[model samples]
Target: MARQQFDLIVFDWDGTLMDSTAHITRSIQAACRDLSVPVPTDEAASYVIGLGLRDALAIAAPSLDPHDYPRLAERYRHHFLLTGVETVLFEGVRELLEELRDRGYLLAVATGKSRVGLNRALDEVQLTRFFDGTRCADETFSKPHPAMLQELTRELGQDLGRTLMIGDTTHDLQMAINAGAAGVAVAYGAHPVDALTALAPRFVAENVPALRHWLREYA
Candidate 1:
């Protein structure tokens, strides 16, 4: 087998590992309805999946006043919680994580979710042990910013050249670019394959099986 090129693998949570995009889109739309703002189209809602809550709402509802951001965020959380959205990990995700871990690759998460939200999800999935480190947007600058990736690499003591970011969105790829790390894109997540390709990721996997194959062969 070819030597693995990456020692540290950073994952994006939403759209990438978990199948939460539709639930999130509904929650955003519900929040908009609560505030009498125009609900964003499904495309608009999904486009912001990897962004911080406030940043996402702003983009999804650009006409809303900035003063309404806090309320919108609150309503989003409320709606999301009340929706009873089941947390479902993508197919092959657990096996993939386990295989990577067994192969001695360090795993981490850099997500747009708040610290509390990520923690809750991790607990529910019983996946805390799978990740060696994590950075949340509420605790750092949001996605497409290099802060999350930079801090993850720093905390892991891994060089940028030996770290890889895998995510479902352009924001995730752009963040990797900003952090001077290589990236792979998963098309089964938020953005389309074409959009991901435009960012120049090292590889674009169409599904979890393909992702596993790519990681084994090239990561």
Candidate 2:
């Protein structure tokens, strides 16, 4: 069958749309410090992007005592939300989303963040209005699970083939493939460009501007 034209553009929230890298890492570090565990480096934190908070905490603090994970999770959420005021949207991301919306594509967010965290970030940045729907790991499953993507498609009554998933992580790429949708990986975010490219995305954008251009031409 011919490739279907896309009507829906799904985004990954954290690293792709929002530049919460430092906030996330610092919050995780705070959580570790609260538990007397060693903090992870920024690179290590990057590897945990697109994972649910529970899973991310584990990956970020692998040496932590297992029994303390729940407490760590709570501490991370509290600290992260407090420090999130410092987080900002990626450069050109708002314009890109506006461009996509203006061109009549339905926009949604599929992220590994929980509903609370996702909503907080969106509300903090006042970016929630741009998206028609948001699917978070708390609502379904984490990246690479396809659960959120499937739920979004079902809720929106859109054909899976007519959806495009854009993110900066391999998990997002795998989620798109799992959902039988088009994957476009952004290079200027969390994952290295080469890593995202190796996932074989339909398109790999070097930055938000390039991604916006691609949406104009293809999505």
Candidate 3:
């Protein structure tokens, strides 16, 4: 076997692992509507999928006062939870994770979800055991800030240079750049393929199978 290039594999939650991009975007739009704030278009709403809820709401509803953020967030959660059960991991994600685990790689998740929400999702999908460590937006700085990856590396005893961050959005790629980790992008997610490609990640995968294949050969 070839030597592994990375020791720690960090994944972004929404668009990367779980197929929750549309649900989240709808929830954000619904929350904006509930607040009587102008609803963001699907593109505008989906663009914020990998950001912390607070940060996402701020971008999706910039016309609203900061004081109403909590209310907007509440509405967002309410709508999200209503359809949360519909979310699922992308095809082949389980097989990929299991293979990685069997091959002795440390796997972790760096997500925009609150700790509570991430736990719920993990529990719902029964995927908690596959991850060695997890970081939530509510617990620290969100994506595009290196804090999540930095903290995960510290917690897992992995080198920044030997870490691989994979996701569907530019935020994930930018975070890897900020953390000095390599990044892989997936096109079938919240951001457009062109946007993800512009980040110059190690590779841009078009689907879960392609991502899995690449990781098998290179991760």
Candidate 4:
């Protein structure tokens, strides 16, 4: 296909690129436990994977006082940063990114992770060079908000209509819609397949290879 559409391809971190859903879910639960707050079920915890940390904690632990959000957030980070609970990129993720970059597609990240978190992960994986620009929740509006996409497009000199957002959650799709851009969903990530489908993304890939195939033929 000769790259017929989309000049910029934006991705979400955590569940989308990294196999960190379980780690994140566990961390959130552990944070709640540490605070002696009601712990969210596995599903409940995982559903907030693509949202900013505070927003996700609020939804996962609605009973917690707002003043304690920082404490919960700190506990969550502490749990996540522990050695055994670490996360890694999905199989073929690095290769897919390399291929896309070589194909001359402008790659970027619009993730719920804070700038420090995303930077650390990218540098640790040595994948930081693949992205031309990146946006984190702490520096701007979080997922499902158009500000990140809007700013990325403007900074990269790309058109919104020619931008593509790829992620594993509905928040990612809604952000694409709000930004007037197209979206592609991956079923292997955080949100359920059904939730992502309801947004009517351009395509829903089942896994990393399938996603690679889609991009090779259509992206």
Candidate 5:
């Protein structure tokens, strides 16, 4: 079978291009511990990979009252900022972005993270220059909802059929499906290959090298 191709590549921020789960987990766990709430395990944290902090907290700490979410969220942000200290682009991610950008592939990020959070990480890593722009969950936009991608497509003037969305979660896959773009799931981050395969993404890669190979052919 022939490999699929695309002209624009959209990425999910946290687990796809950045190794942020450790910071994410640490922040969430610290906040929960402070509130006397049970801390979620690493595996459980993966379930919230493509969700905003507020939504992730709701899912991870469901037993807590909704009224307490704001306080917890504030604490999580504080801890994350102070300790979200460790972050680096996954090996070969920077090269892959450079290759894609040089090849005339329009690059953008559509993440469930908030604008502030995404921008902070991007700035820290000096990667904000790589993307044309980003669509964040803080703008009342979340993955699995086509609005962000749709808005991005319109803003970038790219054809939806030639656009591709890549990430490590079902939320990212569903966003592609909903927005009429191709979906590529990566297995090396938070989710296992079998789990990502279940979603039937157009392509799936196990690591940054594999992803770059596939994107070179597909993009």
Candidate 6:
């Protein structure tokens, strides 16, 4: 394997590492129903997966009143927390993260989830220990803005050239671009591969196993 090219590996949580797209979509729909607003289609809901919750909700259900955003967000969270939703990390994800950590790479998460939501999910999945740091959208600017990645790199003292962001959406790739960091896009996520490819990521992996291989060989 080639020597690691990145010292810090920043990951996007949903659709990239965790298979939570379905759960999130359902939650958005439920929130719309709760507010008596027109629900967005699954594709529409999933399209906003990498954005901050309020921003996502606004885009997904544009007809909804801004005054109802808090309730909409609350209902979404309520539905997401319901039992049996079964949000889990993609297969091989834990192993991949562990291997990267053991190989002396610093791992972190830059997510659109709120701090409370991210913490709960991390605790639930037992993945908190794997990350050296985390930045959440509620605590900073949302994706495509680069504030989250900027903060992560600044806090970790990592150079932009030696930082890599891996995610499953154009928003993620754009965030990397905005941060001046390299990115790898994963296909089996919210955005289609073609859309992600247009952003010119260093590589596009079709699955978790392929992503692992790419990181091993080049990242």
State residue 98's C-alpha deviation in candidate 2, in Å.
Answer: 1.8
lDDT of 2 by residue, 54-78 (tens): 8888889988877888999999888
Give residue 26's lDDT in candidate 1 (0 to 100): 90
The lDDT for every candidate, in the order shown, is 0.93, 0.84, 0.93, 0.93, 0.84, 0.92
lDDT of 4 by residue, 1-219 (tens): 378888999999888899999999999999999999999999999999888888999999999999999999999999999975555899999999999998999999999999999999998889889999999989999889999999999999999999999999999999999999999999998889999999999999999999999989887
Query: Per-residue lDDT tens digits of candidate 6, residues 8-94?
Result: 999999999999888888889988998899989888889999899999999988998899888999899899989777659999999
Candidate 1 at 49: error in angstroms? 0.8
Listed per model in order, the count of residue pairs whose N, CA or C atoms clash below 3 Å is 0, 0, 0, 0, 0, 0
TM per prediction? 0.97, 0.91, 0.98, 0.98, 0.93, 0.97
Worst 10 residues of 6 by lDDT: 1-10
lDDT of 1 by residue, 82-186 (tens): 755677999999999999999889999999999999999999898999999999999999989999989998898999988999999999999999999999999
- Local distance difference test, candidate 5: 0.84
TM-score of 2: 0.91
Inter-residue clash pairs, candidate 1: none
Per-residue lDDT of candidate 5, residues 1-219 (tens digit): 333577678999888999876777777888888899888887786778788778889988888899999999988888887842777789999989888777777899998788877887888889988888689887856778888789888889988888889999888888888989989998877777787889899888888999888877756
Model 3 ranges with Cα > 4 A deviation: none
Look at candidate 5 and give me any clashing residue pairs.
none
Candidate 1 C-alpha error for residue 125, in Å: 0.7
lDDT for model 2, please.
Answer: 0.84
